[model samples]
Each structure stands twice: as structure tokens, then as C-alpha cells.
Target: MKDIYLLSGFLGSGKTSLLSHLIEQLKAEGLKPAVIMNELGKLPFDSKSVDEDVPIKEMLEGCICCTGAEKMEAQLQMLLEGEEFDVLLIETTGAAHPVEAMDAVLSPYFASRLNMKGIITVADCKRWIDRDKMTPQTRMLFMEQIKHAHLIVANKVDLLSDNEIALVTLQIQGLNNHAPIIQTSNAKLPLKMITNLEATYSSQEIQQAAIGKQLSLSSRLHTFTEPVNKDEFEKWVKELPDTIYRMKGYVPLKGHKNPFLFQYAYGMVQWLPEYIKMNPQIVIIGDQVESIAIIGSAQND
Candidate 1:
């Protein structure tokens, strides 16, 4: 059976940074690995950051555990059919729950082909402690991610003092005491240790637990295809409602030969030149995002 690793954590928890290092280490050991990167938004940036010539399947525009479950399974099937890799690593979006993510991966179709190594949850010290600022739903989602992990990586220790680290550790222990906690800044850990982390829960347990837990949360995905004026788009993005937690896509800014890739989260917006040109499109993810206000004139499709 092939080993499958699930990396789970909240947004900005450093899963991607750890993924890059893990990939490099795997390559150095002469082992081939494949990746399934789940993004809550349409445009995927983590896959591009891997910097490895390996099979990478991006399940975008929604969370793999919820809206993108079917697509993730399809991608997994495709990858399994194409090449044989020693192991598979799935990086879940920050909003993904480990139980649901694992449920999607352990579908009966891939039962014999994949053996789950373990679920590794990366907890951002700062973010984990800032629960008071999170919505009730968001806080529940965050706690759920850590509760199902076999190993909890308390990341960003460098950002905290010794006393703070202890406090954070105690808090995590309160939620999950069985999972071994590893401390690191930027999620740095021995690659071998990660590859060999023993799972606390079996795949069967994961599937069973995830059966009805999915219905507890409501997630929605919204896509926009029309291009808007660059200035107007920026203004719209700046004022996006708090209900919309994540947004990503490519936009054709006026006077730019290529469309720019945009990502927004936690009230911050980032835009950069895209190497590949594409029509204007954006995806928004959140709880009940019925619609977004259009800005500026639409460009010709």
C-alpha cells in the first residue's frame, strides 16, 4: 500500500512552507512523491511554490472536505492511474477539517491503493491563541482541525517567548492530549520523523466519524467571470464583507498584457503578475456568500 499524508491547519499556519521542505527531503532520499493541494480559492499559489517536478493536483475554489470533495477524489484517482509514487501528500486548505479531509481520501475506490500514514496538524501559535477574535463557527473549525490530528506541530515558536510557548502547549493539550506536539518556527521538522509519524486514529475511524460531521458546517463557493476595472476591483476587494473569508483568481487589470493573480484573506489583498494569461475569473469562499457587488465596466469576453 502507498503511504498518504494529510497536512491540516488553519490559514497562514505554514503548511505550504513545510510542504516545500518535505518535498525537497523526499527528493534527496530518491523517493518520488505526489501532492494534492486543496485551496479554498480559485487561483492556486501553493502548488507553484513547491519547486519540484512532481505530480501535483490542485483541488481549488473550495475546501476539499466540503465543496470540493468529489473533485479531490477524481484528482486522486487520476494521479493514482498516471504514475506510481512512493507516497502522497495532501495539503488541506486552512479551513479544512482533518476528519472530513481524511474521509474524502479513504473512499472505497482507493481503499487498497492508499494507506494513511497520519494526519499532521500545524497550529500557528499566534492564531491559535487569538480564538477570541474568531467567529464562533471559525473557532469551532479551527479546534476541529487539531482535535483529529495524530501529530500536532505547534508552529511559529520563534514568535513566542518560553512562557508563551508553554501556555500555547497547555492550550493545545487541553484540546488534544494524545497527539505528540512538536515545536518549530516555519514548521521545520525532521523529514524522516514526519514520514514515519504513527497515526493515532485508523482510517476506518476517520471515515466513520466523518459520516455525519460534514453536515454540521455550511460552506458556499461563488465564482465571477466578468472583468472589472482594476481600480474599481481593488476598491471592491478592500470593502468585501466579512462573510467572505477567502477570495482568489486572476484579473485582467487595465494596461497589463497579462492577467494578475489575486488572493485575499483576513482583510488583506495581494496581487501579482501571472505568467499564464487567462480570462478574468474569481472565486469566493465562505459561509453563505450569496453575491458580491460588481465593480467597474466589464471587459469583452
Candidate 2:
């Protein structure tokens, strides 16, 4: 049977970054890894970061727990037939509820062919501290993701103070004491630490926990026609309302030869230089994001 692992986390929790690391380590161990990346936007931006040689199936424009559930079963069927990978990693959208996502994956037709590994959740250390500022529904969804995780990765510890780190650790432990929490920067950790985790919940338990209402988050895709002034872009971000939770993609800036990879979560922003030229676009995910404005003459896709 093929081993299947679910990567769970909230928006901007560093799931894709961790996925890249996991793929590198798995390949070094002489094992083949495949990925199924889900995105809220119509375009599959995150899938582009995955290595070219690895088999990937993208579920776009919807969360797997709801509109994309049927597509997931079809994609899983195709992957099982066409891929020769040892492990399959399914990265759900940031707003996806863990129980519903797992239920969609545990389809009766394909369940027997896959060994269900434990869920690996990447918790944003800073987000946990400021979670009270979020809406009641959004906060509940965040807690649910952590509550069902078998192994929790407390990422972005570098941004926190010593006291903040200790407090966040204690808060997460209080929520799900059964799962082992590993604090790290940029979601970096030994591959064995994840692969060695045992399944914590049964199929029955997952069904039981999937009783809450689904979250209603939205996304907007803006394609940049030309490079914008970096300073102006930063100014716009500063003025953004608190409803916008996550923003990520390639953005072309004036004076740069290539577009820089940009990521925003909570209130923090990060920009990394990209050596290769990529399509300049950004995906904004949050509550009522369609009404949000873009800096340049970019059209929503």
C-alpha cells in the first residue's frame, strides 16, 4: 500500500516551504514523493514551487472539503494508476477543515490501497498568540486544525521573543496534549521526525470530529502587467484592512531583473528574490477579499 500524509495548516503557516524540504529529504532517502496541492485561487501558484520531476495533481478554485471533494477522488484515482511514488502528500487549502478534508481523502474505493499516515500540522507561532483578534469562526477553524494533528510543527519561532515562544507552546499544548510539538524556524525539521509519527485518530473519530460548520473564506487573483514601485506596494500593504489573512505569489518590482516571491500572513510580510522569471501575479485570500483593491493595473483572474 502507498503511504499517504496530509499537510494541514492555516493561511501563511508555511506549508509549502515545509513541503519543499520534505520532498528534498525524501528524495535523498531514495524514495519517490508525489504531491496534491489545493489552492483557493483558480491558478495553481504553489504547485509551481514543487520539483519538476515529482508527480503532482492540482485541485484549484475550491477547498477539498467542499467543492473540490469530487475532484480529489478523481485525482487520487489518477495518481494511483499513473505514479510510482512511495508516499503521497496532500496539501489542503488554508481554510479547509481537517475532518472534512480527511473524509474526502478516505474514500472507500481508494482507502485500502493507501496507508493513512498521521496529519502533520504547521502552526504559525505568531498567529496563535494573536488568534484572539480574529473572528470567532476563523479562530475556531484554526483551533480545529491543531486539535486533530498528530504532529504539530510550531513554525516561525525566529520571529517571536523568548517569552512569546514559551507562551505559544503552552497554549498549543493545552489544546492538543497528545501531539508532539516541535518548534522550528521556517518549518524546517528532520524528515524522520514526520515520517515516524503514528496515526493518532481512527476513521471513525475523524468522522465524529467533522461536525462543525464550514468556513466561508474567499480568494482573489491579480495578475500584474508590469513591475510596480516596491515602496508603493509596501505602503498599500500597510493600509490593508485586518480581514485579509494571507497573500502570496510572484510580484515584479521595478529595478529587479526577476519577480520576487512575496508572502504575507497576519500582519507580517516577507519578500525573497527569485532567480527564474515567473508570471507576475498575487493571490489574496481572506474574508470578502474580492472587494479588496490591487496596487497596479492588474485584472482579477
- The number of the candidate with the highest TM-score is 2
TM-scores of all candidate predictions against the true structure: 0.65, 0.66
The whole-model C-alpha lDDT of candidate 1 against the native structure comes to 0.72
Residue 7, candidate 1: alpha-carbon lDDT: 94
127 in model 1: Cα distance from truth in Å? 1.2
> Residue by residue across 1-301, what tens digits does model 2's lDDT show?
7888789999899999889999999999999999999999988889999999999999988999888868999999999998899999999999998766765675544544566676788999999989999999999999989987778899999999999999999999999876789999988978988777543222431111111112223334566778999989989998999877667678999999999988776689999999999877665655455557778763432
Candidate 1 per-residue C-alpha lDDT over 61-117 given as tens digits, one digit per residue, 9 for 90 to 100: 888877686798799889988877888999999988776676567554455456566
**Backbone clash tally (model 2):** 0
lDDT of candidate 2 at residue 259, scale 0 to 100? 94
Global lDDT scores for all candidate models: 0.72, 0.79
| Cα misplacement distance, residue 56 of candidate 1 (Å) | 0.5
Off by over 4 Å in 1: 199-301
* Error at 175, model 2, angstroms: 0.1
